[model samples]
Target: MLFNEEIQRVFKSDSWKKVNKKLIGKMLSEYMYEKMIQPNILSEEGENIEYSLQVSESKHYHYIAQKRLFDSFDVKWTTIYIVENDGRKEADSAIELLVDLQDVIGMSSETAGHLIKEMNSTLIADAHLLEKEAKRSDELIHEDYASLEGYMTGHPWITYNKGRIGFGYDDYLAFAPEQQKEIQLSWIAVHKDLASFQSVEGLDYEALIASELSEEERIRFDVKVKQHGSEPSQYYYMPVHEWQWKNTLVQNFPEELAIGRIIPLGKGEDRYLPQQSIRTFVNITNKDKHHVKLPMSILNTLVYRGLPSERTVIAPKVTEFIKGMAEKDHFLKEECRVILPGENASMNVNHPYYTQLKEAPYQYLEMLGTIWRESIYTYLEEGEQAITLAALLYEDHHHKPYVESLIDQSGLSTEEWMEQFFKVVMEPLLHYLYQYGTVFSPHGQNTIVVLKDAKPHRLAIKDFVDDVNISDQDFPELQGLSSEFKAVLRTEAPEGLTQFIFTGLFICHLRYLSNLLKNNGLMEEETFWSLLADAILNYQSRFPQLEERFKLFDFFKPELTKLCLNRNRMVDYGYSDDDDRPHASEFGKVTNALAAFQLNRTVGSN
Candidate 1:
């Protein structure tokens, strides 16, 4: 084959073994929290516990892990060993462990089979990551925002984060974010009747087109439209991922192409880099250009990385609602100075057949759409640098955390750095939940940490089309929204709304940070979580009028519902194509560490 040399280079014996061993440790740590495999406690030594999992009559796996808050575990990758009929050996294969536990965990044969493929693909990506000589965390701290995304890994919570089912090995090499390849986006013009375009009140389609495309490029594309025997005035030009055009659009929308309803315009002048989410692209040539989110029908972390048709249509409206709040409220606008990067415009072209099909698989309906979001570069001040919250969880090849490097560079102790982090991230999120009865999924990927002099300064939250949610309870603030608007945005009950912050931020992102800090001897987990409680309490003190709302959306409860990303694929939902996208599976309850800190604070005050 074509990739003989490439394969030989990336899949060397030593590199492959190391990636698999690391993956197995992650699998064990996450599986324990999800209750997928209840391994018996073999012994205990302080926080570190030795555990044995009997996979079968003749086989068992043993490892050492440290139990942390939120009912989590940190498996020591070097300590894992597997014993079979022959003898005990160091565990080196994640697939072997998955196969051994398939029956033990009650996973169906079909699910197990698909999971094996996903796990193998994840291993391949991991091996590629391992083989490359990566920049140290300290060096990466000074990198630009767009370039920094190419360094960090994927979701901290999901084990099979890069299981991109739709991609071939060639596609993975060319398009994966870590590869950091920059390419021009291919453009397509759709007949006005077949496409719908929407934008915020001030911007229209003409203005957006003018700002995005040069006068010469517009003329060149207009000529292409005329060649297809369609008037340029009757079509809306939009950018499409080259992979989507080749893999999904040409195959799915043959009828549109045949009838001259969808015409291919050549690639644009600007070269763009794909962000962590494979579908979203950032313009590298012009930093202030809008970030483009296109549909790429790949099964990655939880859902197809495709924009939902309904959400695509209403994305700009959601932006107006979210930005409107920030503009009016003095706290959000002036005091907090939180950044809301709006989805300024969107275009959706429904599949001619799937749109009419009742309960069609969701991936087909979402194959072609684009959302234009305001660039983060446009909002940055002179001294501010923006990094995704996920970057904080990254550890370099030397096992030094990026957050520690940030703290050292900031001239602040770990506790001081952490206090500022909690305050900057929590105040805006809490205000949205308690005051406006709204919440953004402040998960690592969606939340941006704005730093000044290497210290957390303010917050910027993005990806509103998919993540912004509101309260199901009737609050006067939400009364102005139309039913259509409400329908597009997910409305959750009080606890459910709170879960967006409590679980999405605390459990999904912060718990891992706390674990890293504890492991690296930076800070105690208790002090880390206690500072978070202080941030929330401090916000409450500022807004006593929202006291009842605070009670309604209580984060200080003794326990909260546990959500599992791994279990969603491994057990409950599986690989079966459903009409709707899968969600995070709720299994049990997580002990609320913040609750304990809150109680301690109240008692000490007394």
Candidate 2:
């Protein structure tokens, strides 16, 4: 039997047919919404709508949509119909959709062709997820946090989220999150001259080794290096994603291999599971061991999955700087309970040639590295479970929402449950931006909300250093930051930093939860946004002393820039080069739905 039988079944079942249709619907709906293509609305009635986008003179596609906030649309896959440029009609196919849109989005034949392959890879993997029927959201809510993450469908906002461009069929079964396989990471002995290691002050490389590996395992590994005629002192031990080792590193580093500079020590016994972000693996065997973030050269979503040397070496400092600020503030420490996972250590091996290219694509320089991020389990209190905030919207086969079950289990009214959630997640995030000028990418994958007795008790945030950034106009709180760390930490205006929250947390994440809760009849949409407004206001009331900071990092602007993730993927990601990694693209504007509802006079003041 395949390791993840349920996922395997999805590929062999008819249930996935509908899911595929829905996916097609999603691609078309979101592409149009992002203004990648404009569609002509053919008809509309109460809850039914029809629209079509022209690909060429003789070809176009049409689908039904259920309109949503910010011009968002939930496409009815069953209704999708396509008319070929040849004047023939048929149902939608993933490849056909991309081919048709090539001219409309200004997609080069090369990019569109490559994108189609990625889309196919993503669709097949998604079919595996849909192969087996999922547990009901209510039932899944009762499962432990980590196990529950295995059920997520993918990013709710980014239209083509599952585009993991490099995996083949066998690789998908072995490494993709849907497979839920416990992979044995390959350990390597990189020559000290070619590698650099950094860690938090007390936790050195040796300590990390001892903690992750058994004494027997450690001795065997050390002895293996000696047998290979290399002392442990002369090399920096690092973990490589097994696939990358076989496919990229080994093939690309022939000179190092010939010189005995890059020694392969084989696999570590510590088993891990790929988290939602496939490149970052969770230590399932130990649970307490640090989560390892490694570079995978696969094109997943917007960027090539790799760790840059600059970001890797200085990750710990980013953690230390941010954690210290949060710990010092009594309100943040006590009432808010925001958890910042310390990125304690990192090891990065730079390519001899790529590192020299000052203008090379970032991916080439990022091809090999590992980051040790503290686990959410490490921060959990007894009886508390940590679940990705994205998991809240997960629907079972029966379409039951997880938050529905959580509210029931907590014995709180739906409104109260949502309020507590907002207080735990939003308040501390706002505080970080307003007081410290620190903004984190609190996207679904990076944010974990801790539940105690079924209520949101606290929040744990990860992806430190690379994903976390500070405003360019450093506030007084940033005086303690190291010049080395600050040099790499991205800086922007406080207004731009709001995108870290608005686009990352709100639009990409909470928007789905709010809509799900309302559609499921758990809570009204107004109640959802109102509770959020109250949380922001209440947090502000507690920090009257930081009034100027509030104005600088304003979250209540009437119109905020709506980041166009789909558009960016179709365009250039970060930079345009085979050697470069992609980054999120931003365009257009979205109305801050909460601006008109400043319904928090009881607590917050302007």
Clashes of 2: 3
Clashes by residue pair, model 1: none
Q: How accurate is candidate 1 locally (lDDT)?
A: 0.92
Clashes of each: 0, 3
Best by TM-score: 1
Q: Residue 193 CA error for candidate 2 (Å)?
A: 1.7
Candidate 2 residues 173-194, lDDT tens each?
A: 7888877888999988889899
- What TM-score quantifies how close candidate 2 is to the native fold? 0.93
lDDT of 1 by residue, 70-99 (tens): 889999998999988969998999989999
TM-score of each: 0.99, 0.93
- Which lDDT values do the candidates have, in the order given? 0.92, 0.80
